[model samples]
Target: MKTYFRLLSFARPIGRYAIPYVIYTLLAVLFGALNLALLAPLLTTLFGQHENAAAIAKPEHFYDVFKMLNYYSMKINAEHGLFRTLQFVCLTIVVSVLIGNIFRYLSERTMENLRIHTLLNLREAVFNNVMDLHLGYFNEERKGNIIAKIAADVQVVQYTVTGTLQVIFKEPLTLLTYLVMLFIISYKLTLASMVIIPIAGFIISRIVSRLKEQAAAAHTSYGTMISYLEEALGGIKIIKAFNATPYIKKRFHEENLHYSGIMRSMTRRQHMASPVSETLGIVMVSGIVLYGGSLVLSNNGSLNAAAFIAYIALFSQIMRPAKAISTSFSNIHSGLAAGERVLALIDQQSQIKDAPDAKPVHQFREAIRFEQVGFAYNERMVLNHVSLTIPKGKSIALVGPSGAGKSTLMDLIPRFIEPQSGAILIDGQNIGSVTTDSLRALMGIVNQESILFNDTIFNNIAFGKPGATMEEVEAAARIANAHDFILATEQGYQTNIGDKGVKLSGGQRQRICIARAVLNNPPIMLLDEATSALDTESEKMVQDALNNLMKNRTSLVIAHRLSTIQNADHIIVLDNGNIVEQGTHVQLLEQDGLYRKLIEMQTFSAN
Candidate 1:
């Protein structure tokens, strides 16, 4: 319940829609009640004894008694001499129903607008927070879970918040208006009719509580299934090569079964809500009929038969709202559980945030320096008291075995993960004192995998700088050696890259990524094994392009092939998160330390 209240805050920004929906709903309910209340006079005019004619002629008297009945006596009485009056009353009822439905439609339209507006803002908020979170958070959490929260969880919240207002507010207003009309008819009978309401409400409350538990389980099962499917598809090649199709199928089936079981339980409980409430209402109606019939018989001289029958019709009208309320409560409870999940995601605070006094950095000069830097993932230290400096317009290379944290070191340069203890300075200004966006904007990164979106070749190349002219895109592509191939394709630069650029070869995709990086023209470049995925011929071309690209920029290279970084101004050899050796290529080899041993190992392997 508390979670639901928190979720409602998202709707606060869109209260313009909610306020009008409330007003429209109330108007709809008023008309609906008017339709029911107008029935009494028509009943008296048609079915009352001739001696009651004078009373029937006075619509006020007939209206008072008509509001007292619990059934459809008005239609029954319309069968006699008062046929014209019945026609008029039926026309009014039709008009009221039409107006009620109109307001109902407007209310729904408003709610839908609110849902879409809130959902868009929610997705934006979640994606923005993801960009701001520390890299360590990703190490401990699955990408699939975060995807589910933004996509599925956010959708759940939209549906629940919209449905909650409709069911809890609109339906209850409709029910309450009818109850007041019932009270005006005969206070005694209206009080009697409500005897079963508390019991029905209690039963509905119990069912809804259980439904919420099942709903929460069902939502969790959905997220788990999505995670499993994501993992299976992401590793489809491995699964197929190992003939693990049956294993994956079994796992999927188990998850589906669990999801189905919870949904079935919740559905059964929800289905019973309306029927159980209706049955109790029927029992209450039976009591009204017997008790009200006794009153008619005992007071036969005073009571008009048509008026008594009219009161019975009015009593039955009250049950519709009661039943609706019962069903709505069940839905609201289920929705609240989903709402809680969405609110939790929206409320998540990033561990890394810009400093209160942060400012945008516009230029780079001097050098980037790491002063007594240390970093950890969870409790395991990855970088310990590490300090380094790279002057502007120089090239530095990091070479190490896998898990030696070469990539982690480069990640720190970009502030992807903040150092646990120490500071990184860009041009003597602490990196933490500048906005992350401005900091990253001044650097370009190209990773080994060549990440590319499923878009046109032109769009992918222009992604680094949106709105780049076709000529500018072509120029960048030419520098990266991708222009000739792009023009040779059937669609030229307009050709689609397919999912993750799978339609392009490893070399083509890498060159396209290079083009994107070139288009940015940042002063700082971080190359994470950029040539590792290319063939020998492609590697030569890309390395030449990179050599030209790195000429005057401050470059940080994470190298896989030892020979590639021999010309680097400085080479840092790392092992177990600590720098073991640092110097020029020949100088490090002469030191006869870790760098010398690594060079000898590579030379031996090649021979």
Candidate 2:
């Protein structure tokens, strides 16, 4: 019940649709009952067949539908000819049906609008929460599961609100309206026949007993299947290279089969509820014919041939609402299970939220200082008491072997990952005390793998600065050595770059990334092996662009090749999560330490 209500809250201003829906549904039910009740008048009055016609007195209360109908119907028949009375009753029944159908259409339309509004709010909420989560969260959780919750589970949850409406208000009220009319015609028969209702409910509940559990399992399995799909798409190159096509296909097929089996089981159970209820309703109707027909034939009871016939019609329709309610229970279980997954995503809190009193930083004046900073990943230490200073307008290089924590150290400067101990300060102000947006605004980053959107070159270059003109973009492109290659393309700067810049070569892609960073024009730059992935010819071109980009900016670069950082102001050599040496290229060579050994190894590898 709690989960059901929480999902409904997404349909905010629910009264906008609720009040009108209730009114329309009420009118539909009222007129629909009249449509059936008029059968009694047609049988009794028009045919001139009631034995006690003389005893028919005017009903005192206006609410006495059956008595009023009988009184007026007989009055019309006597004053007017038989054909005229038939016209009056038939017209009344026709009008009742038309009005009833109109109101039903209106009620259904209102509910559809409510479903769309709820879906809008729920999808937006899930996406907004997802975008606000910290980077580490994406690393720890599967992307497919997140995508499924945002896209698929949210879809399932919206229908839960509709199901809830049917269970609580729409179907129940309709059922009540039918029952009230049945009791009015013959209360004794109505009272005696209520025994079959609870029995049908108990039997239907047993069939859908496991739907909620299975639905939860199905959602999990779906997420897993989606995860497998993502992995297959992302690693297609590796799969083909190793000839693992058969293995991958077999693995995916097994999960697909499992998910399909679960859905089939759920469908079988969900579908059984309606038939079971309908069959029980027919059984109840058979019993009513035996019991109530005896009362009409005896002629001593209130149940007449006309009224007994009307009673049976009303009783048959009462099962419709009952059947709808049972079907909704099945839907509600599936929805609530999906609702739990979507709500869990919305409930996720980002660990890297700003402090309440965090200040906004605008510019960098002095150096970025790391004072005894330490960090670890899952109990494995990556950086230990690391202290470094990158002064304003100087390029400092960090060179190390694999798993030496250089990238992790660079990530700490931007607060991408916080240090376990100690503080990093920019111009004497603690970075942790500043807003993440303002802090990140002062720096530009470039990774080894070029990250470009599948958009035109002009749009990609001007991504962050939305209002940039062509002149400004051309200037940035010129600085990164990409302006000539861009203009040489068929569409020039307007050329569409395929996914992740696949349309361009490695060097061309790297130049585009550099151009993007240059357009932002931050004073602090972090380059993570920016030119290491390029060939000799491409590397030289990118190296020159890097030289131009770092002319006066304070730069912290992770140098994969020792030759690239030989000209750096200060080079920090690290091994085993600790800085072993710090000096210029010549001074480092004089030390005969880990720095000298690395230079020799790189030189040997190059030869």
Candidate 3:
């Protein structure tokens, strides 16, 4: 219930929609009931007339619609005759139906707008929160499942929640209005009908009792199937290379079947509620007939022939709203289940957040210092009491074997993942004390993989600076050696680079990534094996671009090929999260320590 209400909060200022909807609905219900209530007078006018009929006695209270209708019928018959009275009653029924339908149309329009409004707010909130979540959350959770929650689950919640709310108000009012008229005609019959109604409701509830559980299972199955589809698309090349198409096809098919089965079960249970409630309602109507007929046949004064006939007609209309309420219960259960999943995502708190007193830092004046910084994952230390300093406006390189914590150490600079212990500072100020956005603003990063979006070359280059003009983008592209190829494309810089820059060569994509980082023009550059993935010819061009970009900037490079970093002012060798050595390139070669061995190993591999 709490989760349901929390989801409802997305439709804030609901009174704006609710107030107008209520007015329209109430008016519609009023006119609709009047249409059925007029049935009594119509029957009385058609049958009650005779050759020497006297005037019908008017009820004491004017609110007694049936008696008053008869009195008016007889009065009209004496003056205007039976033909005129029949025409009058039929015309009243037509006008009542027309006005009722108009209000019904207006009410439906208002409800649709409310549903759309609720969906817009909910989808926006979930997506914004998902974007703000910590990077590790994505690592621990599946992308497909998150997409499902934000997209599919949110859609379900919007319609069902609002629809059930509509039923809660509109259906019950309709039922009550019918009941009031039923008792006015014959209280004995109305009381008997009310007794049988609860039994119908009970039966419908039991039939749909398991629908919520099935609905929850259906949502989970669908999410898992979506995840499988995403994985297959992402790794299509690998699957093709390994000749695993059949295996992948079979795997996805199994999940699809499971999801389909759950949906089929849910549909059966949901559809069953309508028929069961309707069937029970029909049974009650049958009983009403036997009893009400006796009252009329017994010449009972409580119900005249006209009143009894109108009473049964109004009673039959009662089944419509009653069936609607039962069906809405099934939908509400499904909606609540979907609501729980969506709320769980909204409730998630990011693992990283700015401190209450955190201040924003603007410049990188001195150096980034790691004072015995330590980090661990799953009880295994990835960075162990590591201490180092990257001084301002100088090139520093980290060279090591795989799993030596080179990338992890570089990630710490941007606070992508915080150290489990110890502190990192910039110009003697603790980085944690600074706002995350401002702290990251001092540095530009280019990763080992060329991460380019599916966009135009110009937009991709200017991504770091949204407002960057053509001249600035061209200059940045020149620095990264991307300007030449960009112009060589069919549209020059306007050429669209398909998904992940697949439209361009490996070298072109990497250069564009460099161009993006250069456009940012931060004081510090964190290059994580930027040239590692390129061939020798492409590597040299990218290396030259990297050299141009790093000019007069503090650079922390994770060198994949040791020969590339011979001129670096400082070379730090790491082994198992420990800094084994640090010095000038020549100084390290002279020491003949781990650095010299790495240089020798790379030299050997190059041959």
Candidate 4:
């Protein structure tokens, strides 16, 4: 119940829909039960048993509904004849049904609106929270599980939460209305029949006891299957290259079969509740008929033929709502399980957030100082006591072997991950004291992997600047050496680059990335091995573009090729998370240290 109520909070200002729905549903239920209560009067009129017809008077109390209807029905029959009274009764039934159905329709439409509103809010909240989470969360969690929470689990919560509300409000009102009519007609029979209800409820409860557990497992299994699907699609190239199609298929098929088995089990249990409740209802009805018929046969109670028949009719409909309530219990279990997963995601707190007194950074006038900085991953230190300064309008190149914490250091500049100890200052102001958005806005990045979207070449280049014009994008492209090839495409700048620019070649994709960075034109540029992944000719073109992008910008370059950074104004050599050398490229070469050895090795490998 706690989980259920928490999920419902997404439906803010619920009274906007609830008030009208309650009004319509109450009217519908009242008229619906009144139709059944009028059956006795109709039967009495048909039998010509108008013993008190001449003395028929208006009922003094409106609560004596059956008497009022019977008295008027009899008075009409005596004066206007049997055919007219029968016609009048039939017309009343028709009108009652019409009004009842109309209100029911209105209530349903209102509920549908509420359902749609709740779905919109819930899905938006989950997706927005996901986007706000820190980068480390994505590394620790599976993509498929996140997708399931946003798409599938949220959908389940929509139906479950709204459906439970209907069951809570509308169904019980209908059941109560029917029960009141039955009690008014014959209290004895209604009391006797009440015994079977608890028994039926008890049986249904036992049958669905394990549903919540199974539902939770089924949700997990489905998420795993989705994960397998994502992995297969994303890694199709590798699977084909290694000829592992059969293994992948078999693995996926096994999880699919397990999911189907759990669903089959859950469906079996869900389908059983309805039939069991219905059969119990039939047994109770039989008991009511036998007991009420015996009373009519003997001169025992206030029960008469007409009223007793109506009582039996009203009692029979009690199971429909009863069955609905029982079925809802089973369905709510699934909903609550899914709701927990969604709420868990919404509750996730990002490790990185703006400080309470954080201020926005506007300009880059001086150097970025890493002051005795340290970072680690689960006690495995990635960087230890590292300190370096990247001066404004100067190029600093990071050269090192693998596992030298180069990428980690660059990530810290953007506050992608916070350091364990010490501080990083931008122009003597702590970066942590600045708002992340403003801090990131001062820098442009081009990574080894060209992160282009499946969009037009124009849109991809002008991504950061939303309202950039054709001239600006074209100029950026020309600066990055991408303008000539972009025009060679069939659509020129409007061509849709297929997923991650799969439509373009290696060199074209990298230049597009550089063009995007150039368009941003920030004071600081971080280029992480931007040309390492290209072929010889592609690398030369991409290197030329990088040079254009780095001109007059405070640039941090991570170079894999020894030849690329030999002219860097200042070179920092990192090994085992410490800066072993720092000087101009020629000065480092003359020292014959780690920098010289790396250059010699790369020179040897190239030859």
Candidate 5:
């Protein structure tokens, strides 16, 4: 119930729709009930039971609704002819139906608006919260599952939660209105009919008792299927290249079959409720006929033949709403299942957030200091007692084999991942005491994988700087040596790059990435193997561009190819999560340690 109501809050100002809908629905139910209740008098009038004109008595008060309707009807027949009375009754029935349908239509329109509004708010909330989560959270969770929660699960919640609102409010009132009319006609028959309802409700409840459990399982199955589909699409090239298409297809097809089987089971149970409720209603109606008919035949009976027929008619229609309510219960189980998943996402607290007294960092002047920093992932340590200083306007290059924590060390400067032990200071201020956005604003990064969106080259280059002019973008491009190749494309700077700039060569993509970094014009640059994946010719061009980008900036380069960083002001060689050597490239080589050994290995591999 807590999760259900939390989902409902997204339908805020619910009163706007609720109040008007109540008014419309109430009027609709009243007129519709009156339509069925008037059947007795219509029959009495047509049968000519009160043949004499003077025998008809007028109703004393309007509070007795049925008596008033019956008296007025008889009075009209007394004054006017039989044909005129029939016309009056027929016209009243037509007007009642017309008014009832109009109110019902208005109520439906209001509910539809509520549905759309709830969907918009719920989906937006899910997506915004996802975007706010820390970078590490995405690593631990499936991308496709997140997509399912935001898109498919939110849609399910919208229909189920809001649809249940209509069932909760309108259906019960309708059922009550019918019961009142039935009681007014014959209290005994109405009481007998009441016994069957609780029995029907119990049966329906038992049938749907396991529905919530099944619904939860179905949600999981569907999410898994979505994950498989996303994986297959994202790695389609790898699958085809390695001739694993058959294996991938078989895996996805298995998940699809499992999802379909669960859905089939859930729908089977859901559809069974309606028929069961209807059958019970019919059995109760037959019992009512046997009991009520005996009363009419006996001398002490209060019901006339005409009122008895109308009572049965109203009683039969009672099951319509009852059946609708029962079916909604089954559907609500599915909705609440989905609601739990969505609310769980909304309720998840992000692990990374700024301190209450955190301040903004407007400038970076001196150096980035790491003091006895250590980090681990679940007790597997990555960086241990690692300390380094990057002074102002100087280039520092880190050379190491894989798992040496070079990239992890650079990530700490911007607080991408905080150290479990020790502290990092930016310009003498602990970065933890600064706002993440303001701290990140001081640096630019380019990774081995060039991250470019499928958009125009100008837009991709000027991504973080909104409202950047073409002149600024071109200047950055020229600095990265990307201007000439960009101009050679079909649309020049305006040409749309395919996903991750697939339309361009590897060197061109790296240059565009470098251009994007240069456009930021930050004081500090973190280059992580920017040219490691390119050919020999591409590497030379990219390395030259990198030199231009790092000029006069405080730069930290993680060098995969040793030749690129031979001229760096300082070099730090790391192995096994510890810094083994630190000096200028020439100074480290002269020491004849691990740095010189690595250079020999690479030199031999190249030859």
Candidate 6:
């Protein structure tokens, strides 16, 4: 019950959708009770009681119902006029059925609106939280699990919560109204019937408790399976090349088997609830019939036959609501687990957020400086007491072996990862003092692997400047040497690049990324081995474009091939997160240190 209450909290903000639903559900329940209650008078009339004798007699004592019926039947010629009364009874029953169906329709429509609105908000909030999470969170969490929370788990919450609320409020009211009708017919019989309700409820409570545990386990297993599948698909090419298909298949099978096992347990528990509840209802109904018949026979006219028959009908109606309520509890338990997951994500506070008094910078000028910067991934240091200064409009090249912290240092410029022990000053202002959005707006980055969407070439380039005119987009593409290739295609700038630009060659994709960065025209540019993956011809073409793009911008280049940055204003060599050499390309070679070894290796590899 506590878990269910927690789950309902997710619907609080969207209560407008739910409020109307509650009203309609109540109205529906009322109509359902009215439908059953109408039958009581009809049955009395059909039994040939006098038309004016309070056919649906309100019971004063248990015997008043039976005495009045017996007295009226002796005077009225019921056998002669039975068909006329039967016709009126059937007409009233039809009207009652019509009302029940109409109410049911209204309840269903209301639930639809609530379900759609609640799930929509929930999905949006989860996705927005994912986007705002710190980069470090992604490094630790699986992307597939996050997606599952947004897609699958959210849907589960929608159906479970809305359905549970509907049943809890609507069905109980229905049961209550029917119980009232039963009491009116025979108070003693109604009380006798209720004796079995608690026992059935206790049994259902035990079953649903176990079901909740299995439901939580099932959701976890499903999430794990999705995560594994996503990982396998993302690396399928490597798996195939290495002939590791059997290994991945075995892993997937294991997850699937585990998921299946949990689902089987959950289903078994869920299926038991309805039958056990209904069977108990039957036993109770039989008891009511035997006890009421004994009272009638022993007391000799103590029970009115017509009212007793109506009471039995009302008692039977209880079984469905009882079954529905038990099932709804199981669903509520499952939904609570999913609700907890979504709330956990929404409640996650980003480690990097703007300070209350943070200011936004409109322009950037002067030098960018990193002073005594230190950073770590867990306990392992990636950057140690690093310091560097690059004047405005100068190109600085970072040359290092792999794992030498070149990329890590570049990431700090955009505040993607903050340093633990130092401050980065952009244009003489500490970047920490400015809003992250404002700080990142002053920079552009192009990585070795180009990231493009499945959209038109024009849209991909225009992504950097969302409102850029076609002329501005064309000019930027020309600067990156991509305009000619783009125009050579059938649809030119309008051509779709397919998924992640897989439709383009490696060099072509790299140029598209460069064109995107060029369109931004930021004051600072960070290039992370941007040309290392290209062939000789493509590298030359891209290098020329990069040279043009670097002009008059404060650029930070992470270069693998030393020749690419031979003309840089200042070149810094790093080894094990420490700067080992700093000077011009020629000056660094003169020292014959790590820089010279790298140049010698690249020169040998090129030959």
How far is each candidate from the true structure, as Cα RMSD in Å? 3.7, 2.5, 2.5, 2.3, 2.6, 3.6
lDDT at position 144, candidate 3 = 90
Give the alpha-carbon lDDT of every model: 0.77, 0.88, 0.87, 0.89, 0.87, 0.81
Worst 10 residues of 1 by lDDT: 67-76
Q: Write the per-residue lDDT of candidate 5 for residues 1-607, one digit (tens) a residue.
A: 8878888999998998889999999999999998887787788788847655557566676655666777777878878977788888888989999999999999999999999999999999988888878778888988888888888889999889899999899999999999888888888998887887788888889888888888888888788878888898878899999999999889878888888888888888888898898889889999999999998888474887888898889998888899889999999999999889988888777777899999999988999998999988787788889999999999999887778888888877878788899999998999999999999888889999889999999999999897999999999999999999999999999999998898999999999999999997999999988988899999998998999999989999988787678989999888777899999978998999988988888631110
Question: Candidate 1's residue-wise lDDT over 127-216, tens digit each?
Answer: 887776777777777777778777887787777666675677777777677666666655677788777788888987777778778878
Which residue pairs show collisions in model 2?
none
- Per-residue CA lDDT of model 2 for 424-488, tens digit only, reads 99999989999999999898888998999999999998987899999999998999999999999
Instruction: Output the worst ten-in-a-row residue range by lDDT, candidate 2.
Output: 598-607
Scanning candidate 6 in windows of ten residues, the lowest lDDT window is: 68-77
Candidate 6, which segments miss by more than 4 Å at Cα? Answer: 1-15, 49-84, 298-302, 603-607
TM-scores for the candidates: 0.91, 0.95, 0.95, 0.96, 0.94, 0.92
* Alpha-carbon deviation at 351 in model 1, angstroms: 2.3
Query: Which parts of model 5 are misplaced by more than 4 Å?
Result: 48-54, 60-63, 297-301, 603-607
Q: Against the true structure, whose TM-score is highest?
A: 4
- lDDT of each residue in 1-607, candidate 4, tens digit only: 8998887887877999999999999999998888888798899888746665778677898888788889889888878888898899889989999999999999999999998999999899899999998898998998998998899999999898789999899989999989888888888889999988888999999999998899888888889889999999989999999999999999999999999999999999999999999899989999999999988889665888988888887887778889889999989999999999999999999999999999999999999999999999888888899999898999998888888888888989999899999899999999999999999999999998989998999999999999999999999999899999999999999999999999999999999999999897899999888888889999989989988998999999888886568768899888878999999978998999998998888721110
**Which one wins on lDDT?**
4
- Judging by lDDT, tell me the better candidate of 2 and 6: 2
Against the true structure, candidate 3 reaches a TM-score of 0.95
Q: What is the lDDT of residue 414 in candidate 2?
A: 85
